[model samples]
Target: MLLFNTAAADVFYKQPKTCPHCQSEHYSLTNHSKILRFTILPVIPLSISYQRQCDDCGYMTPVSWYALPTLEMLSIIKYFAGVLLLGYFLIQTVLGVHQQTTNEVSYINKPKLFDTYFVHADKFTDTPKRINNLKVAQLVEFDNDNMTFRVGNYTYKYNKDIEIAMRTSMLVQDNYFSSKTMTFRKEQIQQFYEDNSIYKIMRPELYSLFGGFVMHPPKPKPLYTGVKLDKHNQEGITYFKDGLYTEALNSFTLSAEGGYSWGQLNLGQMYRDGQGTQKSLEKAAYWLNKATQQGNLKAKIELAELCLSYDCSNLNTD
Candidate 1:
């Protein structure tokens, strides 16, 4: 039993020179109305009763059957249409800005493969062992598939394995090749033997796996002392491999505080395995979930394994 009401007032008609009753020049005709509704629904027709008032005499008289002008109705329609058009444009502008921001974020996260170089051999071989050292040549191309390069006025097509290895080694050197970030599509680590520069810097022992080719040792670079999250995570991995769990935990914690996904994954693993502190499934799940939210595939796999092997009834599945 709810009651609702609305009221409005507007000029119904303009008086011609003077009021009829008072014989005054100042006069006007105005209409006032009220509408009743029940339960928020209109239950009465809209009606306007006009009144003629003489400004000089202070006299009022009732009038009837006043219709709204066609021009006034058109103006109201145009005003509403203008408001709708403005709202539509505003919505499009907001959506465009949101899409642009999304594109910018994706561009920053994806690795750019521009202006990169690779090494390939002309003689086709199943393994790096059969590749002739003299046939080794420098190549540069943009397309990931069908690598075409010219070396000494001779064009050659490089094997897919060789291309994959070169790209993987490049990303590794750039510190972006990892499970927590971007990883190589193929598991052809054996092809790394093709790159002499990478072998000399990373795996010198693998040199014997390929043809013996003399390569100049890389010059020593200045050690970095700045606080970098990736460096901290790498240091933590080194300590963990050496069984210094306390030092590894501290490094991982520092790296995780800086929002490194790899560091968060390692810290979560340490908590689950009870390496540097008491084993706590809750803490492990918390850190692992954080890493998973950042697109860490390794963290997702680890969290799934933890849930399957332990009590995770209270864990958030979402």
Candidate 2:
């Protein structure tokens, strides 16, 4: 419940008079006090009340409907209006400053992928020492369709396998860790692209151009089980490739539980293929849909295939 009241002591009306207590000729009779109240219970009065007083003698008397001088009333009105306007402007200024400070701190705290790293294509070699010795160059452009990029005046091309790896790395960097979380905002993505060296560091192939620089990819923090989710996902992929479906399923399950999209997609595929698990279209669709929500194109394609082949009319393929 909200309750409030306002009280004002102002000279509503004044007149020259002789003080009864002080017996002074310089006495002034004035109507002063006023109060207004609002309460949840309707017991409080809403009207303003006033009282008259002798300014010199401090003698109080009852007042009934005293008339205020026009000039004095205008002066009181101007004073209150000025105070309210100043308070409003002060509040607005404080809020604006607070919002600006918050934005500045947020920008300062955002994760940065690299610090002063540069690209080098001409120094392509097989030795780590040579790669370290190579001078850094500035990157120009990247061609997603051709899987090629330009650093300085040199252009480098990568194979389809490398392209897939690069894209996977980008996706993992974007989704696997909170520090490197990606936003869908075009302005933010553009800012990241322009301000960071992530594009050059994303692919080992790009690092190969710098004489196999061999910068290790960033990994997620280990969980309570002392295993990183990405490691489990990678292990699952390796097991799957080696035809170890049962082991792959275990690893993928752990990874999927940890919210790894790669593992989710793989687990969905295993469920669909009946590899180390009973084939269940419902389970496949569920896991695939989970992965697809995280921008997993492969999972989306698999989901589309499942929808097409099984005539899953209830599924939202789009």
Candidate 3:
């Protein structure tokens, strides 16, 4: 659109200069006549019986369409055609139009979803490490298979799988998490887990300010709150992924009733797919509607497509 408008402006600028005072063909129209060509495509193909002319002297003007139709007695049909073409493309955009169609829909997004993070690398997205009074938490090297890194004092132990999950997993991407440097200091990681590090680290404010660096008291699993826990939810996710339909259904059903959005999404998919649950589009739509009401954007998009597909305009999603 911008390019087209620029081309239109170019057309206007290339117009021949004409005098309106005297009834004389004063200006050099030869350059304009020879160099610039004008094309007006109107819907109805308006015929221009009279060319551009000076208002005062009634002398024929050399310029094409610069001074507006009202100023130059522009042919209505020609203007109408141009407007129709623009309107054809822009009407839906301006009018907030929607297409009602019943069809399965798929969505694709650009590949560059999340910023990449390399281990041992520091500084991710502006949050700086202020290691003023760095408190070291002596962590125990309990998990032999676990990988450890200590940024300043915070020691994180994870399998390479966990690191990969944090770095690239779609599940983590949906929930807001720190994208900044999650680098670790290995020795510090060992100390923090042992509780010896907690004893030694006296200052809390220091840890608070230098976040992502030191360890803190571990909190209870969020499982009880009904939200699906991360891999941290050891026993819960086991049967859920074993393809055991009953167990998976039970887990998701419990988790969904517990107010887990992921549970809702999966259970909705289950209904949508007719796995252990009865095949129910209505239930799919219902749970999707429920998830979206909880601020799930994916659910909203799905519901939008579903609504548009089924032509369910009478269904009040709100």
- Candidate no. 2 TM-score: 0.28
TM-score of each: 0.28, 0.28, 0.27
Model 2 lowest lDDT segment of ten: 145-154
**Model 3 clashes, total count:** 22
List the RMSD of every prediction in angstroms.
27.7, 24.2, 26.6
Off by over 4 Å in 3: 1-240, 308-316
Using lDDT as the yardstick, the better of models 2 and 3 is 2
Order of quality (lDDT): 1, 2, 3
Residue lDDT tens for model 1, 1-318: 646455353453454347777788876665554444444444443564666677788777776543444543333332234346667899999998777546433322332322122223222222243233222222223233333222222222444443344434422233222122112221121233243311211112222112321122355685986544598899999999999999999999988878999899999999999999899888898888878888889999999999887776776657
lDDT per residue for candidate 2 within 52-72, as digits (tens), equals 456666776554543444654
Error of 1 at 287 (Å): 0.8
> Which residues of candidate 1, in runs, are more than 4 Å off?
1-229, 313-318
- Per-model C-alpha lDDT, please? 0.54, 0.54, 0.43
